[model samples]
Target: MHVRFTLQIFAVALLVSTTAARAGILRVYPGESIQAAIDAANPGDTILVEPGEYYEDAGSIYGLRITTDNLRLIGKSKNSHSHPSDKAGQMSNRVRLIANGAQETGVYVAPAGCEYKNSACAEELQGFYLRGFSVEGYPANGIQTRWVNGFQFVRNVSVNNLNNGIYPTLSANGLVRDNISYGSLDTAMWVAGSENIRVIGNELFGSVIGFEITVSNQVQASHNKIYDNTVGIGLFHPNGAGNPPLPVMENWVIEHNHIYDNNRPNDAPDGSFQADLPPGTGVLLMGVSNHVVGKNRVANNGFVGIGILGWCSATTGTDNSCETRPPISDPAANDNQISLNTLNGNGESPPGGILDFLAADLVYFQLEVTVGAGNCFKNNKPEGLTFVSSAPNGELPSDNC
Candidate 1:
């Protein structure tokens, strides 16, 4: 009996070792192909890439496409002292994935067999983590993900990418934190058609729009520094072409961010919709409701600090080519709250289009034909608040529920 029991224990140990070997780390050194190792890895395996400049011209659409689920692509450092916080050392020790202006995207995470419209589809693909890389010079986006769930994109740098720097579309329950992105032709970081996303502790600059949340729900964006863009932060509805089918942009909380000095000219590609954004606007809310903008330092922007305009008002009188199709049903900016923010030295100079409109610290363009309901601004100090509107309304209500 004692011999039989020992044999059973040994067989169990062998089974455990076999299972561990199946999910092993595949390491790729310099001069080796990173894509080969990724193609060889199973789900739940890690692809560890060594420090080198990898110029794999694999994707004209996207350089590296990750279709498998639960895969981790980590950058392995040879220098023991290199840390992600030390910019110079981190850049030296990073696996630099460069598109060299040839590929459209540096890294594209495309999980299979999922549809974002179904709430239960998030369970189809799980556990994707990308960390510690310098991804740059792509025409479309640095790192983009679609139809992914429970993803983590942290401690990465994206620069000089077109369209967007880090874009996550049709994803759910993701965390995008501790990243630095700049010099994109469009928005630096855009979360579109996603749900339950947390964009925190990131810095974005030198893009047409620093950060944008469009057609997404249950988003919380806080503790970010946004500057040197055409528009610092934008919350927009889905009214234009190529927009998602979602009708409402609601339940968003944008708080405690430093949004200032957005004086850069809009350099987005010609005929793009973002090229219509006025330079030096700090924050723009176009036809989005049930959102909160609180406890932010919005200063030194040339145009209005925060502008709430209807969808038709924003898109109307511009080039007819920049029009939203199917005409939004509810075009009024309603039921939004802007409170407890430090707004100072804003609207120093008005733009050409809004020259006749009052350049105040906060301006709400109330439509003459249809009045929106439950739109209020209060609990902000320093008195002397101004309003720009067709009708003179006194005493905004204090309820910001």
Candidate 2:
């Protein structure tokens, strides 16, 4: 039975490889519309856009809308290469997609009648690859993908996008790597309601939040340079409507990232939840569980290096500001592990609201009377590495998780 199952898997893999090999490549030139080529292409086909500035504004909205599945949108430059590293090095020759103030999103990747909340529909839409392009000047998002599976967004540069630079919501099993994203009013890259998504080797700066994992599970953000944002990395569960059915954010592993100097003033739009985030925050984990923050070099921020807090504690007395319907039954942060991180020079001057509560290295605030188990911290390097807690003694138990 095992041998037969293995052979079936091999046969399926071979069929997929054969199909991809047979897929044709469609080329779009400077004057030709990219959407036209995309509409003309079939599934598993490749759209090679030549090196030039392409303005995708269709009367009321902006940029190209991709509804097709298994499509690879690649930029063809003078230095066009297959690998992400080589493409990043030759960014000067990339095919640029400019929104030109008309559109909310530069590239919108979503098919009709299939929202990300439907796991079956999301799983059916697979193999979307976007690479080697510069997406800029969108009012809302640079590249937004909803409910896509097995997607690859690599070697892309997103700048001056208003809300999010690379926002993938309700997606699963994707790779967002080797990207440079900056100048966003909100998060540079936000993975919301996603699972098994890897955001690695990306540079995110000059945004409200460098990287955010919201209501997402099983995400791994590693080796990314996060700096010059209001908050370096944020893991939170907001009280918003229309969120995915996933009730809790869990099992996220953030490791080996350079999180530093995230002191940029909050520039998110007024009335937006992110505008209220405290600046100079290195990593803020609120209302999240079963997460690991390890092996990171967190330094030189004016506020807390790493903050773990419950939902109520983080946003107290803010009427109608948080999600109400979901009713976070247990808002206390629980079962989190922080280990082996290099923390230094944080909380030099904390923000106003949390000034008295700030700690240089790490701070934990649990609003609930009954704390959950297995929140541990250990083996972190020493450079003013203090752990401040809301307990009576202002200390926590030893790390034994």
Name the top TM-score candidate.
2
Name the weakest run of 10 consecutive residues (lDDT summed) in model 1: 114-123
lDDT of 1 by residue, 122-178 (tens): 444666888877787887788887778889888788878887898887778999998
Clashes of 2: 3
TM-score of 2: 0.88
The stretch of ten residues in a row with the least summed lDDT in candidate 2 is: 319-328
- The C-alpha TM-scores of every prediction are 0.85, 0.88
How much is 286 displaced in model 2, in angstroms?
A: 0.8
Residue-pair clashes per prediction, in order, are: 0, 3
